[model samples]
Target: MSTAAAHPAVRTRSLGDRRRRTLAWVGVSLLVVLGVFVAGGVAGDAASTTALADRNLGPSAGHPFGTDPLGRDLLARVLAGLRLSLVVGTTAALVSAVIALVLASAAAVFGGVVDRVVSWLVDLFLALPHLVLLILLAFVFGGGTQAAVLAVALTHWPTLTRVLRGRAREIVTSDHVTVSRQLGHGRGWIARHHLAGHLTGHFLVGAVLLFPHAILHEAALSFLGLGVDPGEPSIGVLLAESMRYLSAGAWWLAVLPGLCLLVVVKLVDTIGENTRALLDPRSAHL
Candidate 1:
């Protein structure tokens, strides 16, 4: 009767085995881009982006992706921004994911007094709109990369908590989980070996989905001047700077960088979807 006693690893394997090879390739592409960003950041310069005369120029050998009104090298800024996005996005999502997992696991596994409290907190957060909460959070946390990360973490954790709670509840009733408990497994052991089997994929999938949202949330705050500081080359900051020049002559400053941000989010989303498909084999059929 207790799924919590189940052999979660076996179930997880069954779930994963149904996925096709395409999912692996998609994952690899994401890793490759991540590597390029890390390598490029070490070699790139945020401040060295070109000047006024060179600003707003179209693609050329000397300057690819053209220049912004401030004459900053759009390509270079993009590369540098990529690094910032990757770091900020990953850290924010991971921090939130951990919090969500902890809170949700506690609620689901315990399920009496603690469950009500955590469920209420999760509901309270969900009741508020994400952007409104993020901005308010950004202000309270104070503006910077930390604020952006904290704001995103605060906003993101609730959904993951709910999902984890749901999975925990289901796993609790599963046959393998019940058997595991009867076999004299400790709570920690059950949670780690069994519950973890059913939940890790969910958490990982949620984390991947969280990545694009993290990037977008950071960019949104930066766009509104509440995100990463101006000196840094964030996509949002770049777009904000480009706004003034767009009226004068340059369009690429905002457009190209925006496109780059857009593409990154899109790619992340695709990866998330593929991961979801891999985890949920019925989706592969659909």
Candidate 2:
């Protein structure tokens, strides 16, 4: 082949290689996060134990993440907090994705008034400030894990719903879909056999992308005292409690947990983005 022809092949190979590397990184990040959660769960009450002698200690050989004002191991506390945060975030994301999928699929498959109503709701929700709405909802729900999850689930669906709705509409109007209808396939049959399969990729990508948002929002709500209960060791709660001690030189209490949360969110976002790129037909060949 000529150099011009070879150039495209080389570019394609480079893109594929980059995607593979991204996938590897995503796997490693997920494993690390999971390990933290597992370790935290296993640690149980160990995270909350206090040893006044170690109070206010900074990072050192024995205490890598240091100790809080109450002398609890910051490392253990952070791990536990991370585990709770991940659980809340994952639950909320799953709930939000399910809501989006149902609304989007119904709107696209049924069309007319259903589509109009869903579209209007999406626009209305999108217009509101997400964090404020989440906080309000969390407060109303009584401020706990359920409240936090519900708040995140309710507020995060609009954008994903819009995306799913568009994709579903396209799928329903495609040649194969029309032929299936012409062949006497019922709506339920067509949905089960055609729409579901076609839209799975979109749903997965949207759900993955929603994970980071859910985590961040949950942490914010907890930090604001409208999320998890005060006694719960969630990332937000950890950060909120650390504020009072910060002025007294317990900086590690907040910094370590905050950094861990940030890293987890970034990793999830990266994984979602790369997954979406890999799944896109147009990008797959490139």
Please, what is the TM-score per model?
0.86, 0.94
lDDT of all predictions = 0.82, 0.89
lDDT score at residue 246, model 1, on the 0-100 scale: 85
TM-score of 1: 0.86
Off by over 4 Å in 2: 281-286
The sequence of per-residue lDDT tens digits that candidate 2 reaches over residues 106-162 is 998889999999999999999998888998899899998899999999999999999
Candidate 1 lDDT over 1-286, as tens digits, reads 4667576876877666645465675777698668748855763764455577765687778777887666777788887887788789989999999889888778766779998999999999989888999999999988998899989888899988998999888887689878987988866787787677788988998998888999999999999988898888888998888888888767778888888888878888888878887677566577
For model 1, state the Cα shift of residue 151 in Å.
Answer: 0.7
